[model samples]
Target: MWRVFLCIGLLLAIWLRWRCKNRRLLEMARKIPGPPTIPLFGNALKFMCQPEEFIKVIKDLMIEYGGVFKLWIGPDLNVVVSNPDDIKLLLTNNKTSIKGPQYKYMADVLGGGILSGSGTLWRKHRKIATPNYGRRAIESYTDVFNQEVDLLLDVFNSLPKGRETDIYKYIVQSTSYTVCQTLMGLSKEETMELPHLQYLIDLSPKLYDIVFDRMTKWYLQIDPIFWLTESYTQQKIFKEKLSELSAAVIKHRYKALANSGDKLHLMNSEEDSSKNTQLSVIDRFILSDELDSKELIDETFTVFTSSQEASAKIASFFLMMMAFHPVCQEKLYSEIINVTGKDDKPVTDDDLKRMPYLEMAFKEVLRLFPIGGMLQRTINEDISISSYTIPAGSALVIPIYHIQRDPNLWNDPESFDPERFSLENTKKRPTYCYIPFSLGNMDCLGRYFGAKLVKTIVVRVLRKFKLNSLHNFKNLRTIIAISTTSLDGFHVILDSREKY
Candidate 1:
């Protein structure tokens, strides 16, 4: 009789907890229109059944319920806002600066790095990292970009002409090579030999899938329950391999500096003979006393995952866009020729600056094929947007993909016209409407670095080959892993533009 009463008490406590949580969330949900939610499961059943079609689902929701709506996974509420006005209000508000709950999934791979951390930790790391990706710092990396581009062109030259090639593969490896060398201090030879580098390249999408799976499944949000799932086991193995790889690299760099008997400093030594040599981001971290070895590994992995993945996809899409629009390609080529005067020479920083039309075309590509498909933030305090009350702790989802393509914001949103990015037209759009790198304080630090690298590679490739694609732009589909990528690899025929 006593044992039976204890069991009844335990069941009652669980029921009460669930009821209390749902009571608050349901109140917020009632204020925002959304797809019908069942009592306990909420929208999880619908989302889980069609996870791959999430972007389309969100687009549909935007149409049905208007710009702002709620998606409930059990008691947790996610208020998705596609309106620029809402996005502006949310991002600009300093209190909502913390990354949303979904980003916690990335913490296993990225740790408490700038991309995944919040509060004082994020602020401290961001301050230290900001200078490394400044205009001058990015400009200094032009030689590294050119070097990588040369290797890429050499591979293209070796390939048989008139055959359709999957250029995305080469671009991915080339961008990886560039980022590894420039940021992690990994030489070309070292990068090629690192098995984990290949593992990371292959595992990126899988890791992303794990995060997505966990995000949609309410049960997986609980640590003890998530550990029971296969994704958890896979993620554990991935984290181990990634950690080992990063730790080994960090240890090697640390040992090298120690052997030299030089005291680590916050800033790079100006008087040192090695000043001319590229100081890797890892090297900077090693020199800083504020950061530990684990922090160094996390930050380096974050850069590796973010920089190469996004840059490769963006470059691939830019090339595909150029191939489909021969008129734009010709105009771009003319600009390149005018700037460099010869296709044989590598594109310099000055040459890149002179190609305004090329820059315009690149910007347009970014507008359409933004790698950052969505940005998420957790509301730290109760907020009101457009007469709707979003209770504190609710996740805020900003659909960058939808916002950029909104017809209300852009004229003929679907057309591939580089002229849309022209200075006059760009000024006409709202401030947050064109957020390829996002907007406000939490925007991407590597915006200029990424842009420079893409432009440099595009200029070099366009100058060497006349691009042609068998794939139609209208038929192309994209998958949103961490970054948006073409589902079907970018295929193009490279005809040599060499004038012998």
Candidate 2:
């Protein structure tokens, strides 16, 4: 009887300790304003029921709760902020450099690439990958960009004039081809034949949607529960196929390097001044020996996935903008004509620099529709922002979508105006106010490459065709997958400028 009494006493003590800990957490959460949460489940049910309305719900919360607010996602605390000051604090501070839980889903597809890795691994891989985006490297890729753009123009020329069509299809295909050639040295024909590339093309969207669904629904976040679901089974198969494909590519490249011997070294050798036989980015990765096969595969997949998606979205946005605002299109055409001297002439590196109006228009499109609508970080230490205390381990969400469209930041913020990005007006905004490629040390390494690629394609296309839209801009909707994209498609009518 005495032993039984002792056991009961210990059980009661453990229960009290757990209760005290939870009480402290609850007290901390109550300090910040947010939507009313229920017992046990918190806001999980609401989020799960309307995962597609996530961004809209966030925007609505921002209006009600001000710049900083707390949300209880199950037992975890998520502190969301849209103020530029808070964003600067979260992104620039080294303490918050670690990725949030949402990125865990990406690990299945991306492995431990820089996008998903943290600490020493991220640092080491970033050091090795930085050179691929250097000015000289990107400049060498311009030839490939021009060649791909020419192919895209041929496809455009084939389309019947003045008939509405979804331009996103052609843009994604062309950008995918450009990325494969310049980054992996794969031609369009070869890319189509690769079973792994085909698998990724078919399954990536569904996989992203599943990951996002898991992120919003708290109960589905548990590994055991998620693994039992149909989505997990599908994801497992997709990842296996993707890994096999990546492995094959790595082996093929390794063999090619071995066969070429010293020739491979000379191709990337800085001392060798011949531009005619410059190597592709993959050649540099293979020759450097800084990354092992798995690491190489991860980096390549990261670059491939990120660059292809972002470039396609940016190009599609530019096409949509050109269609809606014909006046801007006319001005852009005049500038292109002035620099190139003829519509038929191919755009050169020097010509890309002379088109300032085109740059402004592109900037405007990014501001309104950034590929990444929100950037996330997991707090590693307690921090204060906007006078609110955010505890360690809480998820920090920086809503770039809301901040960029904030009425307080810009006059008539929703209006499509390219002049808003002019040097004088740009200087007036805060540091973190206009981050399409993100900001801080973790900013997109391929920003310059992506910008150049999109501009090259846009310049080439605009020189040949006039973009016009059949649909209303106000009625258009967007869905955020890995990137923000048109909910429907970017339907536009392309007419040859010669006809105009």
Candidate 3:
């Protein structure tokens, strides 16, 4: 009887501890302002709209709550962070390394590859894959980038007069070709031979479309309900097609690697320059035998699909910017001409250094239009800031869009001005204030290659053609999806330019 009495006392102690913990967390959450919540649902209903309308909800919340706010999506508490100092603090913290629960939406598409995976899997994959994308590898791929961009221009040249081509369409294709050759180790002709190449290229964007739909609809996030919906069905179809393509690329690369000798050392300069380079992305993993069949498939999907849109959309944004502000465009043109000396001479890695105006303009474009509007991180431990303490297991919504466009961060934040990114002006802002590709621990793996690819393509295109943009910067309606984009297409008129 005495022992039984002691057990009850211990149980009572555990219950009290739990209760106290819950109260503390509640107080912390209440400190941060947010839209009013309803019981059980919380702020979930506010997000139940179309993907286009999804951006509106975020904008509305930013207007009402300012930078640091909180949202209760069911039982989950998501702290919205737009303040640059808080953003820098969280991104650098080891405890905030895990991607938030929302990353689960891409699990079907990216698998446990570097982009979607967290913890051991992510760290392991990153360790093995980092070397393959090093400086030497990216520089060697410049030839491939130049060739692909020139091919893209050839398509533009063939367009009929007054056609007003959607630059997004052709640029997406060009980007695919660049990724295939540079990273996948597949030549242009080899990628073209795949029966479903075009289908997968077109389907990639639609896959993200479905991802955004499922993400916004809170009910469909549940597996029991989601599996019954059309999205799950469509997701399966997308994966099936993606799997078939992955198999072809994998098999070809495997066979090619098998047939070759080690060739790891830099051979004499007298031989083929390619002979000195390191192995491809898949080659490194295959040689190390660190990843299984399933791991390889996931990594492939992560790298291939993610690479398609990020660079394409940025280039498309610059094209529109060029059209909207021709004076800036001419400045870019003159700089490119002065650096390269001739229209036909390929812009080398060396030439890019002298083209500060081009870099400044691209940076400004990125500032005006970040590819990712928000990034979500899961806090693993209690993090205290100047205003409040963020409890463990809560999600963090880092609003990249609001932070870059905030009135406090930039003068004339709405206007399209390349001068804003001039060396003198760029130094005045916080380092985290202008993260087009993001920065710090979870920084984009493809940033260097992506920048090189876009700059090379822009230079090549500008050398031969002048842009006449059809949209105005002030009135252009933009939306956030897997990528932030113009609600309407990037329509432009390309006129032939005088050659050097």
Candidate 4:
């Protein structure tokens, strides 16, 4: 009887503590407007809906609250900022430069890799990784990009002619293969032959699904509550299995390098590779003695998760847009033909640079479906914006999806217009108005590399096929997840350019 009473007392005390925290946070946040909150829950239930529905809920909230508003996820306060001025103020502020505290939740899956890393550790990883992704390095990968694109074309050519197909389906495989080759620095044959390597790659998508689900639902953030769920059980199993596979990879690489008489790159040491671009991402990580075996695995997972999504999903979206807008397709095809000009030569970095319209069309695709969708920042100190004082420790939520689609920001925002991105029009747009790859210190490190790959695939595919859709753009719907994706596949029918 005494034990039962003690348990009840502890439960009640915990509840009261969180209630008081929420009430106190609500008091501070009252200066900023927001959706009404329920006791204990706040706006947590609002996010319990599906990912697509969750995107809509936030869009609705943005409409109701105007520029800046607060949302309470359990006792946590998140201030959603809309306009460009406020976004600049928050992002540029020293307080919010580090990855948001919210991403720490992702650390369970991502570990301390770039996605959730901060401070000295993040800086070190960035320094070593940056050289591998810079323009000179990306320029070096042109051959690999062309190779993957040609393989992608081979897949299309092998298919029966004149049939409606899901181009995104084949695009996924191609992009996945690209990530393994270019980023992981593994051969396709090796990826297929090595079960452990393939398992790690295949396991990521499933883990992302589970992680995103947990991220949206506030209760799932609670360790005790999450432990009770099936998702936790699966993650627990995955965690152990990942440990096993990662060790296997580390062992294999060490043996291969030792046998080849190649030296491992050490932390803070000068890289002696003929060119940093020639070494794959895994090579750089292995070189950086700062990262242990586990950290290597974490970084590898981070790259695969980030790279594969942007490369595949954006390629899908870009191709689908081509099918929907044939005139734009002809315009892009003409540009490609003008650049390459009937020579069976591969596209050069210079060729990619000359095609501004192609760049514009790609930008528009990202604007419609910002891959990150939302950027969250952790506030380190109090900051004043407009009439409200944003307190330190609260999270800042910048909904990129809402900003890009806000009717006031873009003329006929829903209409696909690559012309909007014309150099002349681009200069007239508000600064920071179009940030598909976020802005400021915490921006995506892989944006340039990802964009390069996306453009490369789109250009090569256009050279081989005229993309057409059986479905209209209006029929397309998106589900915002790890990456924004068309709810249904990007259904496309390819007319071989050869037939012309």
- C-alpha lDDT of candidate 2 relative to the true structure: 0.77
Relative to the true structure, candidate 1 has a C-alpha RMSD (angstroms) of 3.5
- Ten contiguous residues minimizing lDDT sum, candidate 1: 270-279
In the range 351-430, model 1's lDDT, one tens digit per residue, is: 88788898899888888888877878888788888759888878888888778788878899877899988889889988
- Please say which candidate is ahead in lDDT: 2 or 4: 4
**Model 3 misplaced regions, further than 4 Å:** 1-24, 263-276
All models: lDDT?
0.79, 0.77, 0.79, 0.78
Q: Which run of 10 residues does model 3 get worst, by summed lDDT?
A: 264-273
For model 3, what is the C-alpha lDDT against the true structure?
0.79
CA deviation > 4 Å runs, candidate 4: 1-12, 15-26, 196-203, 236-245, 259-275
What TM-score against the true fold does each predicted structure earn?
0.90, 0.89, 0.91, 0.91
Which lDDT tens digits does candidate 3 get at residues 1-500? 99999998887787567547668677778888888987556799998876667776886788888878899887678999877887788888888888888888988677867887778888888866775566778888978888888789889889875557789989989999888887778878888876577888887777887776666667977889989988788888888877788878888788877677553232223442334355677666566567888788778767777777888988998888888888988899899888886556666899998999888888887887887777788887899876778888689888777677878788888788888887788798887777766666677788888888888888888888888865577778877775788888788888888532
lDDT of 4 by residue, 1-500 (tens): 99999998897798788767656455678889998898667899998887668778988998888988999887778998878888887777777776766677678876867877777788777777777677877787788788878888889989888888987667767777777677666666654554454454556556766777776788888889988988888887777766665555455556656655444543234654334555667777776677986788888767766887677878888998999999999999999999988554577888989998999999999999888888788777878887687887688888898799888788888889999998788887687778788877678888888898888888888988888878899777887665577777778898888888
Worst 10 residues of 4 by lDDT: 260-269
